[model samples]
Target: MSKVVMYVSGFCPYCAMAEKLLRARGVAEIEKIRIDLQPEQRAEMMQRTGQRTVPQIYIGQTHVGGYDDLSKLDRQGELAKLLEDL
Candidate 1:
């Protein structure tokens, strides 16, 4: 599986959901960047993703957007392909 990184806040429900889904998809580890703890990372997250939202996820180097986008990819059967290690 590919590396999973998520930019998240402490109280974000979507972040938890995204993580749960990722775990279900065989992602053993998720590198969670807690923007709630590191405020400066919020600016970095927005700068990189162009969205000021919790749970900005990345599968390896590919930006996977938020929980909805991740769920969509899973629903469409693309997430599995994306998670496959090269």
Candidate 2:
């Protein structure tokens, strides 16, 4: 499986939902960077993704944005293809 990275904060419902969706998609491991614990990581996430929201997700090196974006990809049937090479 591809590497899944998510920049998240504590008590984020979107982050939890994102994790559950990814897990259901056969993602065994998710590298969760808790920006709430390390404030500097929030800046890193914004710089990387150009967003200030929690649950910024990446599948492999491809930025998948947030949980909504991930779900959109899944609905479009592109998510499985993205994971195929992993």
Candidate 3:
């Protein structure tokens, strides 16, 4: 499976949902960067993703985006392919 990284906060439902979806698709480990604990990382996330959101998700090198974008990819039947591309 691909390496999964996510910029998230403790209280974000979307982040939790994204994790659940990823796990459902067979992702074993997620490298979670908690921005609530590290405020400076939030700036880095925005710079890299251009989105000020709780769940800035990346599958390998592809920016899979937030929960909505991730789910859209799942609905389009690309999530599994993305996750397994590594």
TM-score of each: 0.95, 0.95, 0.95
- Whole-model Cα lDDT per candidate? 0.92, 0.92, 0.92
lDDT of 2 at 46: 95
Candidate 3 Cα outliers beyond 4 Å, as residue runs:
none
Clashes per model (N, Cα, C within 3 A): 0, 0, 0
lDDT of 1 by residue, 1-86 (tens): 33898999999999999999999988888999999999999999999999999899999889999999999999999999999852
Q: After superposition, how far is residue 36 of candidate 2 from its true place, in Å?
A: 0.4
Model 1: lowest-lDDT 10 consecutive positions: 1-10
Per-residue lDDT of model 2, residues 1-86, tens digit only: 33889999999999999999988988898999999999999999999999999899988899999999999999999999887766
* Segments in model 2 whose C-alpha atoms lie over 4 Å from true places: none
For model 3, residues 14-67, the per-residue Cα lDDT tens digits are 999999999988888999999999999999999999999879999999998899
Candidate 1 ranges with C-alpha deviation above 4 Å:
none
Candidate 2 TM-score to native: 0.95
